[model samples]
Target: MLFSETELQRVSVVIKGILTPYVAEKIDKNHYRVRTEIKRPGKYLADVFDSDNLIGKINLHVLSETQKKSGGDDFDSMF
Candidate 1:
């Protein structure tokens, strides 16, 4: 999920050394939903762009199947 004060023009994720563009669905004026399949476990970066300007960068962490079953990290819940 991504949100911005301005409309987002595009969203792309860097996966496995490749820049992949994902479909961004606009829920309204400032909200967007991006769905993409990631098969590997690693860290990724999602770039958000509005027109020609870079608006935000999002960090995505993917866990392996085993790690997910083992309850990978609870630190995020602390917030």
Candidate 2:
């Protein structure tokens, strides 16, 4: 699908807002690495800093409508 530059920028802003508290690094074209403390459910505080420990990553690739419905694995078999 085609998206205008303005539309893409809006999407980026939304992503940044949702990823707050944890620092996000754009490691690639669309991948991001997020790190935080190691705490279980209900143990996380709103203003706690745990040394910015390593946590996990997130991918924010744009997908076509068909890809969204089809699980976006059309090329998985090639590997």
Candidate 3:
């Protein structure tokens, strides 16, 4: 795997502190997919990197009450 279990756990904690939760799903022997939801208002952001180089990011917004209220069970289901 490109990332170790320890690395995934570390990232998960960081994501949770930003007001979202993430579960790391191993995509293959060398890749992973992070699943999460932005459950609050305003912009939500997270960044992934390899050393100093940026690898990925999530920048999302829940600007409407309906959007904030919808489709958030996935976070609870992850546990």
Candidate 4:
């Protein structure tokens, strides 16, 4: 999820030091949703931009299948 005072124009992710752009959809006046398929497990950063300026950076952690099973299904509680 990405939010800004203005509309968001682009979304991208930094995986293993590579910046890859992803498709973004406007959900409302100031909110946007970015979806991407990450096959590898590791740490990543989601970058949000509005026109010419970068507005946000989100930290994302992807766990492997084994880790997910061991961690249980209550994902929200792990945070």
Candidate 5:
């Protein structure tokens, strides 16, 4: 999937909004990827400032329709 400049910007905004409060720091970003350091809240960051904390990582991927539908390892051998 190809995203236009505007579309990518939109995606970035959405991702940033969701991630800013948890990330230790925002490393960098591009159209296809973003890298950052983050740790869990409260216990991990008692008194630290961070853009986003690390509860988990999120990856935005564009998958083909067929791949999305037949997606699984349970039938890998059968396939």
Candidate 6:
């Protein structure tokens, strides 16, 4: 089979033109972010979980008596 290089370039230009800048920017950022996770992996459910303990029994307490969280889980979710 034979193909024309000019036709390929035209299709490429059309595809690039239709993609919005915001969408394109997000895709670019996501591509690079994948690398960081591999370098220094953080907590993952699979890593913490095992056959014997899916959820730690210690976390099942009904109430929290801690001073920081007085009534019902008032835990600070600060980022």
List TM-score per model, in order.
Answer: 0.55, 0.26, 0.31, 0.54, 0.22, 0.12
Best by lDDT: 1
lDDT of 4 by residue, 14-79 (tens): 334656667578889887766667878887866655554666687877778888887776875677
User: What are the per-residue Cα lDDT tens digits for candidate 1 across 38-64?
Assistant: 788888876666555666688778778
Can you rank all candidates by TM-score, best first? 1, 4, 3, 2, 5, 6
57 in model 3: Cα distance from truth in Å?
Answer: 8.5
Residue-by-residue lDDT tens digits, candidate 6, 1-79: 1122222211111111223111111223112111111222232221111223222111111222353264445355532
The order of the candidates by lDDT, greatest first, is 1, 4, 3, 2, 5, 6
Error of 3 at 78 (Å): 40
- Which runs in model 4 stand beyond 4 Å of their true positions? 9-16, 63-79
In terms of TM-score, which candidate is strongest?
1
Worst lDDT run of 10 residues, candidate 1, spans: 8-17
User: What is the per-residue lDDT of model 3 for residues 1-79, given as tens digits with 9 covering 90 to 100?
Assistant: 1354434323331242565445456665556665556556776566665444455665644456666455565775577
Show where candidate 6 strays beyond 4 Å. 1-61, 67-75
Q: How many residue pairs clash in each candidate?
A: 0, 0, 0, 0, 6, 0
Each model's RMSD to truth, in Å?
A: 5.3, 12.7, 9.7, 4.8, 11.9, 21.7
Cα lDDT of all candidates, in order? 0.68, 0.36, 0.51, 0.67, 0.33, 0.21
lDDT of 2 by residue, 1-79 (tens): 1122221111222232344564444454444444544332222222222234323233345444565566856676567
State how far residue 61 of model 2 sits from its true place (Å): 19
lDDT value for candidate 3?
0.51
Q: How accurate is candidate 2 locally (lDDT)?
A: 0.36
Q: In model 3, where is the ten-residue run with the lowest total lDDT?
A: 7-16
